[model samples]
Target: MPHADTLTVVHHDDTKTRYTDVRYQLIRDGIRIWSREGEHSLTDILMTHAYRRREQKH
Candidate 1:
């Protein structure tokens, strides 16, 4: 079995530009089994993570 988690992050640049980041992770047995991260939308990150999980089960 696996567990799923999502996180939102922030970064500030020298030019005072702020960025929001989305990250998704699949963990098993207290360790991270898979991860997807980028500046993408939350919906995209979740969908991609789900697809990858299904593929790995076969």
Candidate 2:
């Protein structure tokens, strides 16, 4: 499983058609692992962390 230290880039557009790119750095053991870039929803990011945590628990 990947650690939260991974950074994920999420691109999105507002109702006005303005593009917004958000970069999220995953924190695990006080370090960063990897990164990704793409258009993602807030729910997607949250679910990613949730899934990572669950995986780590096993």
Candidate 3:
């Protein structure tokens, strides 16, 4: 399983219809950690994890 602190989130919007569908994905080291389809806000996704780590400068 992907480490909670190392996961990065990506948001995508599907506008194939009148309404927009949002997709949220958490990825770690080029691997998909989690994915879901819905109308979730970025703040909602960030708040789900309490121990998120900052991206390291490499």
Candidate 1 residue lDDT tens string, 1-58: 4333433222222122222232334333122223343323222122122221234665
Q: Please list the residue runs of candidate 3 whose C-alpha ends up more than 4 Å from where it truly belongs after superposition.
A: 14-58
Give the per-residue lDDT digits (tens) of candidate 2, residues 1-58. Answer: 3433333333232212122233344454222223355533333222232122343554
Reference-based lDDT, each prediction: 0.29, 0.32, 0.33
Q: Lowest-scoring 10 consecutive residues by lDDT in candidate 3? A: 14-23
Residue 7 accuracy (lDDT) in model 1? 31
TM-score of every model versus the real structure: 0.17, 0.17, 0.17
Candidate 1 has which clashing residue pairs, if any? none
- Superposed model 1: Cα runs more than 4 Å off: 1-4, 14-58
> Model 2: runs farther than 4 Å from truth?
1-20, 29-46, 49-58
Cα displacement (Å) at residue 27, model 3: 11
Query: lDDT tens digits, residues 1-58, model 3?
Result: 3334333343234211221222334443222233334333243232222144569999
